[model samples]
Target: MAAMYQVITPQKPAAILKGVGPKVAEKLSSIGIETVNDVLFHLPANYENLSVMNLADAENNDKVTVMGTVMTEPAVAYFRGGKNRLTVFMEIDGIYVKVTFFNQPYLKDKLIVGEEARLSGKYLKHKLEINGQRLIYEAGGGFRVTYPMGKVMHSKTFNKIVAEVFGGFSFNYDLPETVKAKYRLLSVREALRLIHFPKSPADIKEGRRTIKFYELFMFQLRLMEKRQKERVRNERYIIDYDIDELKAFIDTLPFGLTGDQKKCTNEICRDLKQNVSMHRLLQGDVGSGKTIVAGIAAYAVKTIGEQTAVMVPTEVLANQHYQSFTDTFEDRLTIAKLTGTTTRKEKMEIVSRLESGEIDLIVGTHALIEDDVLFNRLSLIITDEQHRFGVNQRKRLNDKAHRKNVLYMTATPIPRTLSITTFGDMDVSIIREMPKGRKPVETYWRRYDEVDEVMASIASEVRKGHSAYIVAPLIEESETLDLKNVQEIYHMFLDCFGEEQVELVHGRMKPAEKNEGMGRFERLEKPVLVSTTVIEVGINVPNATYMVIFNAERFGLSTLHQLRGRVGRSDMQSYCALISDPKTENAKQRIDIMTSTTDGFELSEQDLEMRGPGDYFGVRQSGLPEFKVADLAEDYRILEHARLSAIELSGEMREDA
Candidate 1:
């Protein structure tokens, strides 16, 4: 159950426990700020102490709060492109001043001709204009110190305690002096005061430093605890297989497996052939051929007359794997799917086959974990996009394998340092190569208005017997950013090309419908497919040579790359065009780097630096333990320190025990 939040006065803060929240206290509970500790830890995101500066001295257009009177009334005017702008012509002192408030209807009523108020905001002077216009800038600072009007202006509501504190009141909490001293951090009250109404930039920096450290420390502690729990379990599996058969299977492939793929595959096969059960993780980049390697491992167990269960994060991926395995292994393996969409009769047959030891492999979503799906001699369990499953889900799947080997596959590149700490208990293998003959995709970032020209180019390729994928970020329109929906893009393509030219698939579609839609695209029944990221993984359409992503800026670096990876599979030259809006430097940089390089490892490193570890891990959706404070990719130093500390503490605990 979620914790009940309560606010306690300075005199009785300690008396109020988790369950002691009053009715009103429950109503006023701030999201993210749950308990007394949460309230204390809710340090300001930033601080702003308004420094008064003369209009002339404020170079680089710094925001300034200045006393001014409305010398003229605001006029509502509409421009040529239906733009409604409110011009507030203000005159202050002997020198004339003009302020233009854009698109604010009530601004005309709020500031009268004779009214005097402080106009605070960033302003820039137009050199050629007769009158320099001041544009209002929203004040940014800690919530508590901002004025009531300021809070009301932004429609933000805070606790009464916070409101009072912001209003210049102080509170006394029972924080231990020793803890504070040890951390060399400021007191809660002092930190809050400085954060809310900082007098200087240095004060704001200090306040943030103190709180950021605590947050990082707590995050490290949680990761360590989780790591400790996983280490204590005596889990093992052994694999014994004919090495010659594995080698023969590899040799049979039309294309030779890369050295990296072979190395990673050997790592997995080695683990399974061990005395202890293998808990292994396979990390790779998009199109690095992790799935092909997975097939070899699955077959190893199958050869030993044991059933293997492979779990994928999505139905599409499951189906893709099912097809791929069935195609390669043929009648040699009795493979079945147990997804949510699987019919009762189909599921029953799968269950019976599994119980009877007739099924060689099983692929599905969470449905594979159903109580009735009993397995006979289940020796190998594999999961794709391992991050989507929680630790418990992975454990449950592992439990099904009994003493069988467990292999987890990820498309996201894990930072080296994080890989060490998170997968401490699991043997790790990384497949970092694409199959030979795979061409590097040409990536481009362009504006939405360039859609017609891009479409013309894609259509030309389509006429030449090539295929393309037009991907949108969302299936349907949401209240968020104005992005092209799958439905909208699908129709737009049909209108641009023809109704018979394009097909659409999204998560909202039924399983059969989605499969059919994807099949049409894959088989070239439909030359162009417009869809969402539901096609982000495992739906291979090798003939597709053009990949266009709308609102590409909104997608994580890894996801964008993966979407691009869908193409460039065949011998034909492929192009990945990113349809971005008025591009920011960061967005341009990301798209440009992808365009310039085909190295997944290099791209992963750049992704780590640009998007940070959170974005990388978040997109990879690999179910590895996510660190709160430590970026396994970036914060290697902190992770090392925490690891050493954990080692020392564990030794002490063992000695005491």
Candidate 2:
């Protein structure tokens, strides 16, 4: 039966359908609809309630469908900008009203004088006007589903295509009968049909609920299967490190580890000692000292004579980790750095040493995932800024080892919703406590008119032997946006502070130039560095005491937090000035939140609610599955129910197998 269902499924190209030629198919593809299944799943964005309403009872601007007699001839009148309006007189419930259609001249031929018709649109009671777009010469009406592809294809054409497809065949229900009964879900065919053409509002709601649950349920099932596959046990990968040696190493550190850091490190070490493969996600806020925890885990792997690969997102970050690890391990371990800028000869030498087990830890960017880079005994893989890399890239790096033990670290705290859906397969550990003596960054929101006051505060801080960062959203001035750019800020700062004291860095700059600018800022040679959001992640400067972001409303709350993290790394009192004149309510809320609290997790939750899951991390780069119906933010309750159902059904299927 499953085989038959697979064969009968409508996986054919949309062009195979009648009236869907190459041109129409191309238009469909433009909106991500390519196959018959795609067209069926392209659900309506909204539904137009065309239920008849009495003209006397209807309020102003009320959406209504009225059955009335056309009393006057439809006359086309020319408006400004060469636009035309078709107007006619209609008598509904014995009240005459003017019905207007803008730019729809063809309707004049259909709305005949002294004829009966139904018109659906917004009704203006004071003017006795019914501004309408849908004029049907038919008899009955209910709810009209409005597809998202109004610009791609006409509503009538799309409706015809959908009706033809629905009339063509039936869909196979994949969910077991018992499971369907348990969840009170509609079958696939019934749900799709009702969602496309529902008789009542309840039908639309029920159909959408069923589809959303099924989508989330199937997604959870796939994740469970992957989790099962990754649960492979191999005793050879287990590490037995010397506890005394690790403690001694920790004692040698300049500062004591935070409780959260210690707890996470212990969690990671325990995972390494187990026989089963380890897949854990370490979430921490910016400046929470996650690197040292990861460093401790890597050192544990090294103690047992195994190599660890530390992959970071940027070359600058790779260098930072390489230096930190080299400093920490001093003469005890061999560490190497690999990046795109590494010379071919140096890269080959490093690769040879790594293959020969001469190197204990290798820190790199995407260069570490190249096929030629082989490890002698890769036991633990640590990916920093894990969100910046896609799942396939991480998998490629994990494939280098037989028994996979991956530790993914992200400074950007994952929202609770994403932690359950996107990283559901992995175990999670969070480091919420900052290191001792580190002060929280003082955050403030200032209007663009107060730029001079903000600059004065920064100048005062600079005079105290501290450095500052001026971040802008764009590198150059944009014709459309009236926001400040890095170039303009850099020159302005250069005039205030000497050229040698100001440096400019942006994404468009050459890597070497950017690195040089950042290096000068780190050395405090440049007291002020104007940059774009390129400095958002992995650039740590403890001596920097001030962070000023121009057009702060342009950035997400999570991003604003990350940029603020660049400062307050040291014990010195640090400040972050958010300078922007926010216009919209959302923009104003972002600034208020930025000034209110410094908690990354809280800000991330607000960000998820405001921008939704798609833009939380960019949709394409987020490595999350694209659901046809379920939304991770708005449909969280449905997601939870579906997850539980998937777990129960999966267990039953396993028993039967």
Candidate 3:
């Protein structure tokens, strides 16, 4: 893989460049750009037409690049927390221009009283203000590239560095002609050049499409090859499930199954009955009853005198599943749990029982994958929130002697096209309809300043005997991030509601502590749980009908969706207020989609379109190679082509070998 990089020998540090010094290098390093290649590959966030705008025609919040002359001396404006804002009055076409820079005291020297300069930022119609202002030197008259800049760096600076590196030079290509021809891919040099600094909109489109295809194709190729190899392995779990028995079990369910749920259950059952080990993905929306489908599948396997191992992401979820499974199979089948927090004696007893066939069903977290955990007749494995664990991790939890059937469940709904393209090796079952008594969660987007308004809504709900959840991005405050941390918010809430009513939980907390906090919220002892994304998956509290996510813009779409799912578990109406004033247009778009729909699949699709592979876990968590550029949502059409091409090439490679 080292050969994949074509950078010259003795890789030059970014500091070696003409204008970069130690201080500038440190700023670049903060954003993971230390090498020349890093600078070359740091792609633009988006392209904006920065043509000079007529002030009379300019609208509020319009991104613009205007040439203006300084009209007044720069002044330092003081804000809270010792933040110093520099303001300079300018005249563009004799119209007033108020440009402000936050914490950039040195910027006062850049703009003189009468010098003409080009400025780039968002323009406002009312105050004639420009926010996020960056002094620009390059005219680029047509379109300017805006980067995801850091302190001490701006899009103009990146443009300068990239232009220098890309000038009068080109990189070499390594893709095979057959593959390149199949995907209609451009040369590596051309793609990089155009991607970083395109000559036209068409170049951007073509370059992006070409790079996206390669990323997606590479991911698909490796997965397809491994899947082909797995297909030839002998199936060790061949015991057939009785159709009549499975039907009898389904009929015994407390409530009638939704048609979609029933159909998905049947599909999974059919896969298990097959001799070829089943590799299936089960997808459903929140409160769509995926757990019941898994329960039904696990029960049928247990009835056949085989063990079923269910792996979850966290201890909270593991315990939650343990209770639910036990309640469902109390007198029907023997069940047990093993987690990281399990006592030595208890773990040993469970291990002994599992190996001796005393336990028919076992639920656990990563503890299930430990070498000491040996199943007696492990025929089936069901993983909840499947993407949390890598492929080999899931495979390790099942019996290695036999190729056991595997069922992966995710409450994060993805488009069917994407599912087929990404998980092409496995069959899929989707459940969109909710079971009886389940209600849809309502969501909204609000600004951070509207905390009082959000709290008022929560108070209204609490007065009606309902509960709420307040989630933060961080557990403790970091000097670097201005985010609302759990500790700070916890204290604020405690001061308002008192200790008896509010408890805290986060990823950093001990398993016992988390369980204690969740227990209080579940039993109504503490009506509110101030937490982090630790409650994102599988923690059920039907009475908690309201969730307020502070700094909601920090989370990914799927994660945000999962957090919202914690509420609206019952028929009672639930509310989710996403407290955020998204600074970027993309951030605002993400929050808007969350407010628009409760459908997980729709939100996932929108997320894909709005973000790249790095924004998501990508193929790395799913046991496939990671993509450097492709977006599953934005490159859906490209993914289709890549999957088909990869399949064809995989067959050809295997036959040739």
Candidate 4:
């Protein structure tokens, strides 16, 4: 009933194309272009207008393509620094213009006298200079598409290859005809053609719109499919714990839970009560008490004779969580900590206790997912700072138990668009309310020239029996970047304060050394601590009222917020000073946003807009779809439309089936 399949489908190797030798194919493969469809989907980054313009109508600094007759032969003029410039005089629309090409002496023989040529470049009328890069001896002129080819191939050569493939193949459209007609979108073949070789700017715009919609629509469809699969019924642990017991445990805490924390805890408990597996994301701003909420959930799970695994990105955080949980549950639950630095005998004993169900809960780093570390009854898996782990790493941990619940926690408040596109398969719980008696951190932006004033303020705070955290961008000196490093700042602080008063911490240090430095600072024995961004996550010192970040412009707004959250944990009036002399507008804006608002969600939205979704928290590794045409920040409306369309279409297909 079906026709024979063709051998040269879109999935065929791209080396079959003309002018594509083994070397060219290898080069293409380096940039992730390995198939015929890949070559088709490699859209242009921008379009260069090569349409000829009259010299009289062109303005200064305008990128114009002008057709002119060469009045004199091109001559090579030697310049300083062993450089040579090829200058050619041309007559365009009865006006004389000088075209110069620097370090391109070979052009003198190609640009002959009295021959009409087309030159595309910036026109400077004051000096009558046309700094030209493109010189065409041909007749046709239109728009030249520019791609993101980083030394992969020349634009002209790539364009010709794309044209050959375009002319030789046909594409099958993914969208149904009815949907395409309703949306007024071009077919796949036409859209790809126009995107690669457009006649005008409008053609490029139309083609890009169609491609963006297609990319988003397909992505949403895949997400919806995955969601449906995840929703299928599975045998899972039904956690039923005593209400009075959880309440009594909560009562023993030092502080009352906020409304948001209680709400999230209730939501998580409700999910655990069901037999179905739980997959939820717990999003909260820094210092919003996510740890306590997760702790409560884990405590509830443990009541049913089930074990919980709390995994963190760093060993320091693992140790912190282990200590916090042990203190909170004190003799009510048996908790063990495992990390790379754990002694072999200790790890073996912990593993034996875990296998025998003696350990009610275990807090560790990636060591939790080891092969020999088997669990008796693992029900809930909590990953703190979920963005730092890859999808495969999470999956390996999830595979430890059959149909276990996963509660991913992040201190970075993700934007709404990213939350939908990236975590669409999971339900989300947000905790936005801070605990009572917590004061907002007073934020200030200071330039490098104001270092004296900043230091004076920090000194004053330390003199008041409070500690200070000084953060730098780099751990050591970098030849390329001139930003401040931890060692430099450590020495500077040592000069201001004696060696006994200052402690330095960085990632390269051993866990014992880092913990020692942090312990000294936490104990208030060291009034000042100099460190890198490793301190951005854990280590809560309520008495540390001052946070001074050097070269704050090097970090994102969300990072700055997290760093500032290190302080402001207590009722004391805390202050965060951002120190930098930014060289770019974007960097300046990031610093300004940090000083303007303490809301992590608002800063995340601003960050998404400024740095885009891919760079926002490294979403690419966080299970975000790598979109070719659709931008999560700019095309949110289109994303919404595409999502709705996918839902409707899938429902229709289900009914039809």
Candidate 1 local lDDT, residue 523: 85
Residue-level lDDT of model 3, residues 1-657, one tens digit each, is 222344333567888776678988899899988877677667788886555667667788987778889989999888889899998899887888788888888888888998997887888778878885677766566567788876558888878877766663445434557878866778666777788777677878888777777666666765676577666545554657666787787778778989999899889888776667788899998878888889998888876788788899888889889888887767787999999989999999999999998888899999998998887888778889888887678767765424478888888887655676557778889998877887778888888778888888887888889999999999888999889999999998888788988989888877787788888898899888899888888688889999999998888898899889989988899999999978888788888888888888888777766665445545556533344566565667877877788788778887899
Off by over 4 Å in 3: 1-222, 233-236, 399-403, 415-422, 618-620, 624-633, 644-657
Expressed as tens digits, the lDDT of each residue in 48-71 for candidate 1 is 334434565554465555556677
Q: Per-residue alpha-carbon lDDT of model 4 for 148-233, expressed as tens digits?
A: 88888987788888888777886654666766887898876777788888888888888888878888777777777777777666
What lDDT score belongs to each candidate, Candidate 1 first? 0.69, 0.86, 0.79, 0.86
RMSD of each: 8.4, 3.6, 8.7, 4.1
The per-prediction tally of clashing pairs is: 8, 0, 0, 0
Residue 36 Cα positional deviation in candidate 4, in Å, after optimal superposition:
2.7
Judge candidate 4 against the unseen true structure and give its global Cα lDDT, from 0 to 1: 0.86
Output the worst ten-in-a-row residue range by lDDT, candidate 4. Answer: 1-10
Candidate 3 TM-score, true structure as reference = 0.68
**Stronger candidate by lDDT (1 vs 4):** 4
Query: Which candidate leads in TM-score?
Result: 2
RMSD of 3: 8.7
**TM-score for every candidate vs. truth?**
0.67, 0.89, 0.68, 0.88
